[model samples]
Target: MLNMKSRYAMRALLYLAGRYGDGPVQIGEIADSQRIPRKFLTVILSELSREGIIGTKRGRAGGYWLEREPSAISYGDIVRITRGSLALVPCAARLAYEPCDNCVPESECHLRLVMLAVRDATADVLDRLTLADPLPGQVELQPERQAAPAQ
Candidate 1:
């Protein structure tokens, strides 16, 4: 349920991860290769740069690059930075918690408890995964696996 902004952030991060140690990648190249809007990427990159997750170099050959190692940057970190909280329900949010606007007492709300569990479970998976990890079911770029998989 992550919004387009968050998805784009991850996509951009992945693009950089793929080119780690290769030098900064221009924002234009990122937008073109990732199919993200250049204007939107400018805003997104600025935000990410402010967050210390990315760094920018200014000049004709300058661009953006990851500030931290790919292994150190988790999906949860990106989501939290862009989305604020992983909780589907505001009352269950750990980083941006706000009580429900109702008479129901927080301690007695079953729904709140379930939502908290959901938030934790979601965080567990995302926090453990990073851009360096290969995605499940993604085919390797090897000649041996070019053919179709077994039925």
Candidate 2:
């Protein structure tokens, strides 16, 4: 499951993406528009700012904006920055792989195999999607219009 921090970060990024090249946006405006808590947004923005994903300014005209183009930023990138690894389990994590504390050796573990496939599928979708892409429910919710993967 996606954590709240990552979810909020995505929302904040989407909001910024919408306003890209416009100018800095005040924290209050973002919090109010996105319905994210003000205090939590401050922390999230600070973390993203440190990552150079977003730039900020101070004073009455100060706020935040994307440091890079929306198309340059992938949903997977945001999730990785906020959640560390995309894997639901440590053993299945490609970037941060670790054997589960009490599990069988990876070579013999079925659970790990399933998790690896899950992680790969998740990455496949998220990495292909950028902040500039219209999310599933944004333009319209059309599950039937989405094609299934080739066998």
lDDT of each: 0.92, 0.94
The 10-residue segment with the lowest total lDDT in model 1: 139-148
Candidate 2 is scored at a TM of 0.88
Clashing pairs in 1: none
Error of 2 at 129 (Å): 0.4
* Residue 26 of model 1, lDDT score: 98
Top model by lDDT, which number?
2
**Per-candidate RMSD vs. true structure?**
5.4, 9.0
Report residue 64 deviation for candidate 1 (angstroms): 0.5
Per-residue C-alpha lDDT of model 1 across residues 1-151, encoded as one tens digit per residue: 7988899999999999999888999999999999999999999899999999999999999999999999999999999988998998889999799988873899889999999999999999999999888889987465564768889
Give TM per candidate: 0.88, 0.88
Instruction: Indicate the residue-level lDDT of 139 in model 1.
Output: 70
